[model samples]
Target: MNFLTDELDYEECDKEINKNDINYFRNIWLAYDDFWHKNKYDKSKYKYVKTAPRSPNTKYGKINDFYRRCYLILETNEYYYPLDNYIKIKKRKRTLTNLEHIIIKNSGNGKRQSDVQDIVKNAKFSKTYMTNVMKNAVIGVEKIKEKKILLPNEKLFVNMDDCFISSLFNNKKQKNRIRTISANKGTDLEKSTKSRNVLKDKKITYMKTKNGERIKRQELIDKIYDFLDLQFIYNKSSLVFIGDGAPWIKTSAKKENIPYVIDRHHAFKALKKGFIFNRKVDNKKLTNAYNLFINGKYYLLLDFLKVNNIDEKIYKYFKNNKEGIINQKENWNQGVCAESDVSHLVKSLKGYGAKIYNDKVLNNLLLINSARINKLNLLL
Candidate 1:
């Protein structure tokens, strides 16, 4: 198992030795290396040899380095041959230490397996090894317990959002959406949303196809609730769900009877998109309308829109999300930043779509990345 040697003492040598002489000796040693012979002997040598039952000595009786071969140690070129009889000849099981596994996991920060392998060149980390580590880490995460419980009558603010990433299966491109939930305790929505403190807990789940059939929306909802339950705040604490005005999100909120707040960013973006190219409304009017919305003047905003002859679609967009908009204006100063959160949580899945051909591994990667972002221990 030795992978190093002491420096040679040229001054004390009886005969002059140079690099060429060392190479010659190395070649000779390599040719007779017992470890290599025991592991790499030609099996064909015994193809024609017949042996009796319970024979004491067979033609090819040497034990093979099965563990090394199975674990990919044999594939590495950096192994150094130990001096003859320097150590006892015993079978050593090749295995990765916890630290080494952590290294492999860290090396996979948003990079493809090939790139990760290149980063950990000494280990020769294979796709199989990385996948197994991630799989195990995800399994370990399931055993984690939520120690923090919400106080009675406490209020919890939760943000839910979905981000899409491209998936390739059998060379056909598909789309997968990852849903994330971030929850924290706060009494004042505006102050809590504006604070820089990290959320107390965060989790991610994704919709992926199984057996060539996509998962049902109910299954996705169940997964989200499971995550919420794990946080120990499913129904105990007053929960407020905040997100962009997506139908699926609104439906989920309504199903749970949780109050939903439309994110200010999305509302403002809709307004800008509605009037960005309209020549009828000038910049002053647009600014005025935004101010009115931000100032909780919903009726005034509607009046301004109607008086300015803005598009009916723009008028309807505000009118429909009026309650959510007013809630944001009155309570949440910064509003929800689920879009930014999604970008951070799923950055690894983007731009590396082609490498992630398997849906299972992609989901596992999301779990691992989310755990890392939440500062959870990934070592298992």
Candidate 2:
């Protein structure tokens, strides 16, 4: 057996030892002396006194603790999340939550749980224990459900998009099983883009379900509004939602009485798609649409659509978001988009060829990622 069991009477095997003495005991007891002592280390300050038989329990306890720490240090450095090895084997099944927290904390920083598992798999822990630790880690972000408000003078720039998780979709279900992914940045775009902390009041909402994506989407949007309500009520600061001209986003903004901006990238994309996909409009008309969009003449563009009978679904999208598109130029100068921010939060878990994430796991990963991006010390 690699570990000390109850076979030996600890009461009879006791000894008094110093720090280095404990290290030597651990090295010999764990059969690690040959490998450990071969490594070049300083030994000038060593006070090695081997006092025999004080208490076997004391000796076993100290050596076991040292053994655990040695194994933990092999996994990571001080910069990484601390490992949890304080639980006894008997109670480990119930007390491994601390280990789960450690894994989740590492995941928050973009490390996949699978990657974390591979790194520590050789340690004295069971695969099921590690799996449960990671599973709970992803679901654990729910504890942060309380609404968090924005600071004064801070505007929340929001965007919504779709992503796929392997666990949620199969070929028969939908080749591209899309889930709702939304992100918001609370700081100034220009200033933030130049710094590491590009997003100030960052929050990400991810919803995945085998079915009922629409219902979950609405719930996610409502959660955003609840957080906004706290800031809007007390600070009187308005929200500047930035999205790709999605109907749900438009509708939610209108209902909440909040102003929004159409992301310039998506606006251009919409125009191009409308012109190409929707019955081919003349090159002249396409040029005219681009001109109007750039000049912020959104109403005139709508009129052009009406007169020319260029009624594509994208056309309706443009009409619904006329204010947002116009606001992108006149009121909010420069291109304000959330594509980069949103991508950063979702790429690892829901990217191409990625493993399908469970609905709860996907949601939890988003929240954890957002907390990291926003520099919020979320509850693990």
| Prediction RMSDs, each to the true structure | 11.7, 12.3
| Candidate 1 residue lDDT tens string, 188-213 | 33444554634444444444343345
Instruction: Record all residue pairs in model 1 with backbone atoms less than 3 Å apart, i.e. clashing.
Output: none
What TM-score, computed on C-alpha atoms, does each candidate reach? Answer: 0.60, 0.56
Model 2 lDDT-worst window of ten: 79-88
Off by over 4 Å in 1: 1-104, 107-142, 152-154, 186-197, 209-221, 233-237, 278-286, 308-314, 330-334, 351-357
Number of the predicted model whose TM-score against the real structure is largest: 1
The TM-score that candidate 2 achieves is: 0.56
Candidate 2 per-residue lDDT over residues 1-380, each given as its tens digit: 22223132222323333334544444444342223323421234232222222111221232233322122122232211111221222222333343455456666345655565554342334445444454455343233435555557445565665554344433232323343344443444565655443544455554444444354436856677665553233342445666677777777777767677777777777666666544564677778887788677889988877776664777788887877768755543345565665466767554312355544455566667766664566574
Model 2 pairs whose backbones collide: 10-56, 14-53, 14-55, 14-56, 165-356, 166-356, 167-356, 186-201
Runs off by more than 4 Å, candidate 2: 1-102, 108-132, 136-154, 162-197, 206-210, 216-221, 229-237, 274-291, 300-313, 351-354, 358-364, 378-380
